[model samples]
Target: MFVGAIEKVDQFTRPIHFIFRYYTGSDIVPGTATLFFVNEEGFAITCRHVARQILYANSIYENYLKFRGELRKFEKDPGFETQRTNLENKYKISAANPIRVLFNFIQCVSAYKAMTIHLHPTQDLAIIQFKEFESVQYQGYAQFLKDSRFAKQGRYLCRLGYPFPEFTNYQYNKVSGDIEWTKEGRSKTPSFPIDGIITRHIGEGSEITGIEMSTPGLRGQSGGPLFDPNGTIYGMQSATRHLHLGFDQVNREVVSDGQRRRVSNYPFLNVGQCVHVDVIKQFLREKKIKFYEQD
Candidate 1:
């Protein structure tokens, strides 16, 4: 039902690809997040969590550099191994802590000198402004639904994002001990669209702030656009909530592959939670960003 709408949304919806590595590991891990253009001036919207990770990437890389510099100072000493261990302990480098984080805006801008991010004080929404860009790579922008009353429950909506990290345009620099984006390997990943009915409305007190969809928002779909069959954006996908169905089976016998087996099953329903279009519009207006709306 939304085949054409998905094509239209794909013009403005872009993936933000990221690569990171833990302090104790040399392997590079790649992931993705979504963002959509709101205007021709290079402004876009994404979840605050995504923006925060972009901002925190600098700190992670800098800390790693500092540790490397400190370790070099003790390389010539007779107790080099001891000093290395001491420094490692001092920096608290571990498997859980990332030593490097890097990201690139995929097909959104040709080139940019810098970018600015404005995070909502209370909402999961955020605004991004690309500065001094040579050209805009995205084809179109989002046209939000004007009247939110049209977004009633039982209406089916589709969300678009890059949930599978199929892109391989990144590598780990073993010599430099850094993870960097490379010119080789595949640079594009396919976008996925999932459709579901509006199950409920989420609110703070009496003011509605979010929409709950019956289907779960897959991983890497955060910050994706939520729209109807007409391609009118209703909200931005922020997160997913898992509801316990209260159907629990312990050590139950079941037939599988022509064999009998005992399995314990605990089921949960995952639902997508999106930031409402009204909240998105208000945030953009407060930031003096230009956007489009349709009746």
Candidate 2:
């Protein structure tokens, strides 16, 4: 039902591709997040968590650079190993800490010298503005649903995002001990669309702030657009809530591959939670950002 809507949404929806490495690991990990253009002036919307990571990337990398420089100064000393450990502790560079994080906006703008971010105080929403860009690369912008009252329960909606980290245009620079974007390998990942019925409205007090869907939102879909078959955006996918279904089996015997085996099972219902259109519109208006709306 949303084949055409996906095409329309894809025109403005873009992926933020990221590569990172842990402080104690040599492997580079790739990930993705989604965002959609709200205007022709290079303004886009995404999850606040996603924007936070982007905002912290510089500091994280710079901290690692400082640690590396300090370690190099002690490399020729007899107490090199001990000094290395001290440096790690001073920098709080644990094994799980990310030492490098690099991200690129995929097909959103021609080139941007800087990015301006506005984060909503209480909601998982954020705005990203590309600055000093030669041109906007996204084809169109989001048209939000005018009246969110029409987004009733049982209404089916589709969300679009880049959930799979299938792109490989990144590598770990062995010389610099950092992760960097490369010109080789695949540079793009495919956008996925999932459809589900609105199960309920989520709210604080009497004001509805979110839409809960019957299906779960994928990991990289956190900032994606939720729209109807008409291509009108209703919300932005924020997170997923897992409901414990209370169906648990302990040591149940089951036949598998013509053999009997004991198994234990527990199931949970995963559902998508989205930031509602009303909240999105309100935040945009508060920031004096331009956006489109349709009934």
Give per-candidate clash totals: 0, 0
Q: Evaluate all candidate structures by whole-model CA lDDT and list the values in order.
A: 0.93, 0.94
Per-residue accuracy of model 2 over 1-295 as CA lDDT, tens digit each: 9989999999999999988788767788889999999999999999999999999999998898899988999878999999999999999898987887888999999868988999999999999999999998889899999988899999989999999989988877679656778899999999999999999999999999999999999989989999999999999999999999999999999999999999999999999999999999999999999999988
Q: Report the number of the highest-lDDT candidate.
A: 2
Error of 2 at 82 (Å): 6.9
Q: Where does model 1 exceed 4 Å of error?
A: 68-92, 255-260
Residues 1-295, candidate 1: write the lDDT tens digits. Answer: 9999999999999999988898767688888999999999999999999999998899877877888899999879999989888887887766798888888899999879989999999999999999999999999899999999999999999999999999898887779766788999999989999999999999999899999999989888899999999899999999999999999999999999999999998999999999999999999999989999978
Q: Estimate each model's TM-score.
A: 0.92, 0.93
User: Evaluated with TM-score, which candidate comes out highest?
Assistant: 2
Candidate RMSDs in Å, in order, are 2.3, 2.0
lDDT of 1: 0.93
Q: Tell me the spans in candidate 2 whose CA falls farther than 4 Å from its real position.
A: 70-90
Residue 8 C-alpha lDDT in model 2:
98
Clashes of 2: 0
Clashing pairs in 1: none
